[model samples]
Target: MTRLRLAGLLLTAAPLALALPAAGQAQPAPNRTLRVAPHADLRTLDPVFGSIVITRMHGLMIYETLFAWDSKLQPHPQMVESVSTSEDGLAWRFRLRDGLRFHDGQTVTTRDVIASLKRWMARDTVGLKLAEYTAGLEAEDERSFTLKLRKPTGMVPFALGSAVGQIPVIMRESDAATDPMKPVTETIGSGPFRFNRAEWRSGARVVYDRNADYVPRAEPADGLAGGRVVKLDRVEWTIMPDPATAAAALQTGEIDIWEQPGQDLIPVLSRSRDVRVERYSSLPNQGMLRPNHLYPPFNDPRARLALAYATDQADFLAAGFGDEQWWKRCGSYFVCGSPNGTEAGAAPYAKPDLETARRLLAESGYKGEKLVLNSSYDIAPIGRMAEVAAESLKKIGMNVEVQFADWGTVTTRQQNRNPVDQGGWNLFVTTASGATMQSPITNIGTNMACERAWAGWPCDAEAERLRNAVVEAVDEPARKAATEALHRRLAEVQPYRVLGQYDQPYARRVNISGVLEAPVMVFWNIEKK
Candidate 1:
């Protein structure tokens, strides 16, 4: 079993509740709310429109998926009651569980599921691959649907249940019918929580109320699967950009949970008796440096290789996370310690080589052009990693400029495809959960689909072919072989630089319990005492 480590020293501390009610306002009962300090501000609510993790968390809170993954990485039915495949394995049928109702008092039907899957497939990597093999998808009845594929593959259920980048969340047919590239105005779903749109304050707070009409699974909660029993009447997300203030809030009982606390503050938080720092997921998060492939310097593979040769994973990891126990050097494109974490082709660039970097830079014909490195100061780790990258690139004789902004602004600016002088970026630093980087099919960083690729716009025919082989392999051994080949290809192409892997522990009050172990932050199955 995956263990949840509780780190804190026992000490006498005064018991305190949340903020008192305003003048003339009635005070609510104790322990009826779960207050959280999220890692980033909630800017977008449409999960299918982008790969933002915060939006994915918001979607999970209000929307339900047809299937879900357990801690063991096994796919199981969530909203689905039963699923069966044909003898040839080309056709699959699914039936929704009874009593599933949307927050707007509408019954969940096959039309909603089909529309949601169609929109999700238009953006998610796994969904796109599934669409390639899909021959037909249609509703059989109000509560059932059938999907026919051109070839027999096991990706149907896995794709539907995957909780990776841009999760496949089921929404109302009316909302799902919106353009996949655009955001939906309405926030309606059949999940455990109903989004409080009227109470949403963009940069300050987001609110959700328990769904009284919703019915959960009978089984106990495990990872993202099983029953999602909500014990609290309300889940309030308070956005605190500063790490110090967030830690202070967690320690004083102003907030019940702190989704992410910096490593530098973990020690102080651990010393407090009221707060417990726990590792929620066994898989560590993987940090990456993504370069724009459409502009100069990085447009050439040699230049990308030069940057890779100059990078030191240890330096990047140490700067972002102070303690060595929280981080490790990783070279694999896929996350280290995962099922496909093989360092097959990373032998040459295992250590930093300034000579190789300089030589490669010269060969690529870089002319000291200004390279903008977009970074977010609000997220301390990302800002630190960008600083290290800027220094490393300078060592390779490249003109580097570090642009600092809040995380929301950074995320928005990186989407611009203009040149550096026109607000475009040459590189940026970010991290993905280990579960998202466990496979070539799921890892958005390794996607080489040219114009259709993730923000980086990496394009390589050989890399794409290798990834497809891994996805379409007949057996586990074949898939492993294909993945190693893809890894070797990625080393040559240098699509992105893998800084390292590290664990981001969660800090919550002692009164909070039943936190399910998962790669992502989940509200379900958690209760306040």
Candidate 2:
């Protein structure tokens, strides 16, 4: 499976010199430590439990997957030595590579891979679908495993090589044996870096030491796959909630990289000759306004549709990205320019009309109920979207209460299902990469299964049926038709509001090299000169 390609829109600015140390100033050697200011703090270490962006980066540092998606979105063997299927298509065999050792000096075994897959399939949507066809998953020998399916399904390799948040990463048998719902306390893997557990401080800083015993693949680096090379002896990730502070730190050479820089600070960073700003992925980050379907106002389909129709994409786009070149007004539920993106049956959200929203709210019997909107001040995009949404809702005559917190806190609070007065939320802002939204199988946020739905808990039988159809589709045309039909139903059901799509850039020192332009941020091939 080739990696999905996104738009070619990119932003790169010439570097300008900032006042700095004189020539006499002694500079530290650049071959050891590489400090970075990530987008968010590391709140959770477990990859499955920590589905956020920051933790996903941490997962890449410590863990290694059997098969990983390349720059073309194609799956390549990583830990696995080879994979072959029987002529009957009922059984698939996998062999592990030699000389693979965990952090604790244990050999990577087929039993460990089987244990890891069992845990990942419990929560991941692709894993659940694969489980439906899988009759048994067991170790064939110490170095190999076999997956027996009740019927032919060609999705096993793709599911195992998922590039999104819920990646099927391998672990030691002891750690992999833990309950899927529970968080693993131990961090041990055979990746290029080993977690320095003693140096870890929750919400503050985390450190990783280069693995001396690890060996890289002979193939060159390509996206998430290929060689795992670590040039730096130590990598440090420090948490800085304020964008201005992070930019200042980067300017002073205190930090080597800033994962997600604020759009407003791009000009300031551009003035510094030491920093270089570039978009890592071609896919833009999509803004989303998710409403809790279990509560009032949004529970009514009319009320939800009103919010979507009342939202002006231009307003949200400007607020979040500010520049026309950095953002695009995407009217479709799926990404606008992607293969699966379509505007079918999307007449209601073409324009924003305050009068239409007011009428819909009145028909839903809304009596000025307070809508709790969670805003994350730490992330510029999320905060800006929430602010614009609050003002838009007020114009429609709805009571709005904005709750401000950090990104991690907002992520934690959005999962609560309690009543509004009991610490529950009514609305929140989130963003997804275009790669995650390109197809129904990868887009977990759109799941509408009754009690097993994603965050907002939308229960739409028609949408669920359409989502399944897309997954079971035989080819591209069939999948496209199902996706188009899903979009038509989504417009009427109004599970969530799409707040346009925008691009984000990463700022790093000019001396750093070997940075791959991939969706997920990986530090393996990166080297600081």
Candidate 3:
């Protein structure tokens, strides 16, 4: 069933190419250029420095990983020719596949892989945990590397194969040598596509040309794993901040795909029989509200709890997902309906009471403190949620200000950990794929490691301890107990709020094919007629 209600908004015609028949049905122009309008601009291509879906998508295009997970959620070797573990399980060795070479014509060696893993471990949440267990990692040969662990862990493969944000993308040793905290400016990898730097323009357009030297695995493509064969000669991403403009472009075939069509504009695109609207993945993107824990009114747990009470899940859900059927009022911090999902700390969110919120705020001594709510309308759903949150905050007698920017701008600013007065943010609206939030280990926002924590810089000793327990839990029951405990603690601390959960839709010309049903966008199997 379609999830959008009829929104009375006029559509404007935009200049775009002509539409071709559906994939395998008709031939496109002689020049095969796959035009795309992604959800946001490609602000940062360095996957280690950014966790946004757009950045991950970019990384998938120009970079390759040693291992990748398939649709069944099983890890498969991508660049690795083979892998083996010692009897004690404390040592693991991986051999690189033959013919693996970076775009610069350099072989992908064990030294490069070790350097990339080291840089990634210094940043990613899963990488940090992996580092803690890793006693030593060194190249054993030109093509093979070994990781000596302090303890036996079954998560080694999963960690290396993870396709979530902050993915451990392999790169040239020289490029990987860049500081983990800084972005790697060069775009060189063993992936099937090479960045067309000459045609790059920030906030305008980015292009990728198919790598003729790339070789595909014998296996069929599935999710981020298996064979990655680029059928198109080139893929160009045109950043259109305005949904109407992007929708028009897709309709006119000016672009081959619209990665994330705004919810409000979905109805307009639906009216076009020539256009096809498809959900990105089976897992939905969850709406979230992350609060700055360094200072505030929010630094106090009571104040954060007041904000949670101030929020009405129904309002945020309705704003983000127009139709009620498309979204859920997920009270748990974890993605509801997942294996470890529980209602442990959902009591306060059961019913929003402004009166209780007022009492809590008074108790916390909040003195009309101003909160800057950074919102990006480039994606309508996020902007709408922020608007709703701002109104709710204002109703509770707190000063709320909504700052406008594109999704890229918000992501860049969220990296700043300065005081709110010095261009820092109080809270921001964004979404996380349910695939990434499936566990405490993969979820970045769940970490409470003080200065090293995710963007919010939250610190909760109990939460951190519970997170570690979840990691160490061996049995299903024990993992469930640990997750429930952590969920309850998160509810009590309120480092971040799960506003709602909804799916993001993508629109493309009928001719486009091979859009994977994976959690992250994969352009490998796609082809244009």
Candidate 4:
């Protein structure tokens, strides 16, 4: 299986800087330690719990998977020595390197890999990546293991390489046995760094100290980290929720990096030599408003259509983002111009045509009824998008209303037949969406599934079936065809209106390197300048 690919999880923090530093600075640069500050807290240190921070900084430091991406985003061995598949495509064999050691002075073996797979199979929110591809997994010897599949799953390796990869990121056999999502002693991994202390001092400041034994593939510049091979002894992560505070810290070197700086400050950052701002309108970060198909108003296809038509996505973008392009106008479910995209949703829903909206409203039997929308954050700049949509419907002769609430409240309301005024949110955005594709799916299908698995309201059984087939089928044409079917259904239903994906900038010192271009920020290529 591939590594897990994350799409807009709000999990990781710290900004990125790809530009090189000044030529003649008298102030020396640090060799090993790289300082970073993110606005979110480290909710948990366990790899299984899956925080974005852990995925970014700590993933490379602590965990080593079967295969990893090199500087060019190409696959290379990290944990496993080599990879090969059986002719039937149901079994996979990995040759391991000898004498690999964990941070705790323990030797890595095949048992640890099998144990981690079992844990993911048992406790992961999604099914194990390589499970259906394999009937079971077992260690044959110290350096060998065989994975037997239930059926012919050709995408297993691709799955293993991604964030939600089929080949699970191997963990200590002991640590794999515990349930750390419940907050147990599951903070151990064989990465470059270990979990020190997760202190939510102000909002939340999670700090990590260097591992003395951590020696990277590249040689260290100095022994500043002391007896510990780490160049920097410690890494401090401060949760600066306020964009202003985050930017200030970066400017003053109080924080080496700041993730998620406000767009309003882009102009200020661009003019400064110390900071470099890089943001593209086309990014994997997209906003989507999904409705619960199992619930009222939404259950009616026409009502759902009414909501889709009434939403002026252009206005939503204009009001909230100022001058940024419509985040990105996606044709398919994924980011615009991404692999597997089908030009499915490029055109916005016909301008909140009150006449069309009203007709659908009446057909749906909702007359002058106020519709409510629940959201975790403030959604609209000019009147709530939900309210704007509702008003548009009203102009068409259907009364509607939109309401905002916490994520928990919105999710709960979406689950039941909640009121149109209170927690009844007919529309809401998805903070995270699991892409079901076998290899990598975040850029291709952020909200909808590329493979099998049901998500969101009024699930699509056909979509689910097609997704599954894509993952199982060996033929490339067959998989892509299934992707087309899924998109067609989405267009017909128009689940939540998807604003295009947009690139987010990470502010870093000019000297930093290897900030990932994909939504899933991996550190394999990251190195000090």
TM-score of each: 0.93, 0.90, 0.92, 0.73
Candidate 1 is scored at a TM of 0.93
Q: What lDDT would each prediction earn against the true structure?
A: 0.84, 0.78, 0.81, 0.51
User: How many clashes in candidate 2?
Assistant: 8
- List the candidate 1 regions with Cα displacement exceeding 4 Å: 1-31
lDDT of 2 by residue, 232-339 (tens): 888999988888889999999899999889888998898889999998887776888889999888889889988987799889889888778899888677687766
**lDDT per residue (tens digit) for residues 373-438 in model 1:** 999877899899999999999988989999998888898887788887788899999999888887
lDDT tens readout by residue for model 4, 94-133 = 7665546687788888888777767655433233334545
How much does candidate 2 score in TM-score? 0.90
Largest lDDT belongs to which candidate?
A: 1
lDDT of 1 at 152: 71
**Best-first order by lDDT:** 1, 3, 2, 4
Sorted on TM-score, best first, the list reads: 1, 3, 2, 4
**Winner by TM-score between candidate 2 and candidate 1:** 1
Q: How many angstroms is residue 219 displaced in model 2 relative to the true structure, after the best TM-score fit? A: 1.2
Positional deviation of residue 443's Cα in model 2 after best superposition, in angstroms: 1.3
Which segments of candidate 3 are over 4 A away from where they belong? Answer: 1-31
Error of 4 at 521 (Å): 3.9
Q: Flag regions of model 4 displaced more than 4 Å.
A: 1-33, 44-61, 69-75, 99-101, 121-130, 164-167, 178-185, 198-202, 215-232, 279-283, 299-303, 345-427, 430-458, 473-477, 511-518, 522-529
Worst 10 residues of 4 by lDDT: 219-228
